[model samples]
Target: MVNKKPSSQPYNLLPEAAQTLLALMHAQGEVARLSEREQLFSSLLDSVNAVLWAFDWESRQVLYVSPAYERIFGRPAGLLLADFNEWRDSIYPDDLDYAERSLAEVLVKGAVEDREYRIIAADGKIRWLSDKCFINQQTDNNQRVIIVGMAEDITEKKQLEGELQRLATTDALTQSSNRRHFFDCAHHAFATARLDQAPLTFLLLDIDDFKQINDTYGHQEGDYVLQRIADTGKAVLRRGDLFGRIGGEEFAAVFPGCTPQIAQQIAERLQREIQRLSFSHEHQTFGVTVSQGLTGITDADESLDSLFARADAAMYQAKRQGKNQIVSG
Candidate 1:
């Protein structure tokens, strides 16, 4: 866990950011005090996992770099000090335009700046950096302005955020897309199909006699059956097809650029694959089959709800005709 600094209020004291900037602000005379303050800032920054530096805004020349450069950027401090290209080259190419624009905003407004971007370190490993900056001081000549900032390594934080997002979007048991994420993907796929005038197939699959399975084998085994069904259906679906467990004992798929004939063939293959799965529960070997409702994008299909309603109607038709069968609309 991260530690928080003490929040005690002082008499007529400035905020944390203002205090930091005040310490960094340059003044005429008091050379000894300035040197001591510089040493204090350098020491404090060195103790933390951040690279503190300053540069000329106009000339883009490196003015100062802290020792932490070696640990974070995987290079010696002298390298960054030697040439501006070293710093420029480390920035990810795709993020360059945005970084420049953000910095330009900072220069114009003199407001504090913060941005997150990727960097390629000297070791050739990609890293995430949270860079922060503000104008520390401007020269009396106005030819050059001092920009001060620190870069913090945020790769681990970014990875954790990504994992959290995956967990939120994924079904825990079946390891497929959850209901919310399924619709999010389907909406995008729906727009693309409409624009390109492409054939898009939708499948609503339901397990036959799912409640009976739970009654006989228990909920744990019923979950296993559902997993097997999802696995089987995914194997039969084409690449780029969207598959998700929308409900208990029910799954859905969106197949873009696939015809109804091909969708029916894949549904048949999925049924066969489920039939091939056998589970030994309470010393009894048994299998389960699925019923599917298939539908394609039509000229009359104005919304996802309409398309899903058509497929859902066909799925119920399959259930009415027989437990294990395919109904197309």
Candidate 2:
């Protein structure tokens, strides 16, 4: 048995002190966990090659920026966070409106994914970036937070896609519209002509004595002649006309809203233009000539194939008659 002395403090006070100490220890543990998490996040920021950032909805101010900004854009992360307008102004002018509209759409929709834009770097280089982001609302419901978005460079990919599209629609030799592209435009023109009851004409042209020229001057000279013919033909045609290299030594033109008489005149003019062109290669100078076949759209019952066949027959007639003239069908 122990002798007990009367104490002023209640027994509950001792338990409360112990509880406070435990609570303090738990808080310290949480701080340590948070510190470790921050360090991990920083490491992640440094490892990526893309720009990662977050912002506030109301101020449109950047709240966080990843270390990758320095590596890719040649600017410190702090500069971007200090003034987001600097970043906005640095964007390519052509892409600025699109970028702003996309951001606004995302803010309204509460999320944005796979938006692409072009940003100017500190080194004065334009870079295409693809961004993905999420929106977070504040607990008090008065403000909104935008989560960190990652932006990856995609300039090279976009350029390659553009080049591929150009190649698909362009002729490799003449640098004009290809056969398929020509047909596509012709189809549209045909549809329009049928709707408006307008006349449409086609000219099928063949290089007169092309094989003989190739045999005499070599294939290189033949190619030069063909290119010159294409150039001259384009120069003489109107803006609305479509011309294309359809075959080895054959070309075609689609003239929309042209009657049979006008088509005949155009074919004759093209024939004269080709005859007037004087080409020289390796000390040899010679004039080029072409035979053209003209056909006009008469009725809705006419098909593109049938019209083309008539033009081809007329061209063959020109070839049979002389080899440097226009035949109308």
Candidate 3:
């Protein structure tokens, strides 16, 4: 068997121009593939109502932006890439530092869950956006790369949440804080007063003969009386004082940094005001009155239950003595 020698010409050799053209072809193919992927992604994003973006970590330059950018940001995607800092500059001044810090923390930590911020659009409209991003750690180098974020408009949802919170904490009838919310606030006030050694007083009031009023004048008139009492109480109270409708015809007020004497004065004033109010329904005029009980936190017992019990006892005492009077315990 004869062993043949290999040819002198380089076995893998091709013409220089052909190789160059081949390299160019491969590059073009890659670019076409990427363009197709981007188009598909853009179409997907456009189908829904969300903004998508990608930024190169090293250059801090925007690499890809979905069409929704124009809808949300009111600017062409090209403009965002043209000036890398444009997007950052559009953040609200109050949120700029916080947004930057949050982004930096996520970049350092290699992932981000969700964050909310306000952005100024090209049309000068301020919009709230919730952004979510994740870092791509399986890169060829140690260079940190973060997947650009997706932002969704959450203004309506946030507004609804605020409204719900208000409804939960406020009394529907009198528009004052409800019993549940008042309890929470009073607990905090008690804690603060205990810590500061400041005097704290509470006033528990009930409309005298409320059941009789409801039966005589009808329930609507009774409701009107309650509303009137709430308004008058609010008007006379200081700014830091807390008042709430605890139950039907029953109201409570928490006075932090107030002594029992001051609370009694305020209670007396409220009693006088209620007696002065005259309600006319269907050409019939009637007078309304409230019995008030006042109690201060004492060294014997510091619990809310104890304080409330004392106040309640005092209120019942007032009711027993007379329909309209202030009793202190």
Work out the TM-score per prediction: 0.75, 0.72, 0.75
Clashes of each: 0, 0, 0
User: Following a full C-alpha superposition, what root-mean-square deviation does model 1 have from the true structure?
Assistant: 13.0
Per-model root-mean-square deviation over C-alphas: 13.0, 6.8, 7.1
Error of 2 at 272 (Å): 4.1
Instruction: Give the C-alpha miss distance for residue 19 in model 2, angstroms.
Output: 20
Which number leads on lDDT? Answer: 3
* Stretches of candidate 3 exceeding 4 Å from the true structure: 1-40, 55-64, 73-97, 118-127, 136-147, 272-276
Predicted candidate 3 versus true structure: per-residue lDDT over 1-329, tens digit per residue: 99988756552477788778888999999999999999997678788667777777777888887788788888878888887687888899999998888777766777676789999998887888887776665456665575677888777888888899999999999999999999999999988988898999988999999999999999999999999999989977888999999999999999999999888888888888888899998999999988888999987766777888989999999999976888888
Count steric clashes of candidate 3: 0
> For residues 198-311, what per-residue lDDT tens digits would candidate 2 score against the true structure?
889988999988998999899988988888888888988888999999899999999998888877887778888888888777798888788889888988445677778889
Report every candidate's CA lDDT. Answer: 0.85, 0.84, 0.86
Question: 1-329 in candidate 1: lDDT tens per residue?
Answer: 99999887663497788876666664434677888899998788778887788988778888888777788778877878889788778888998787778776777777555688888888988888888888766557775678888888899999999999999999999888999999899988988999999998998999989999999999999999888887776788888999999998889999999889988888888878888899999789998878889999988888778778888999989899987888998
Worst 10 residues of 1 by lDDT: 20-29
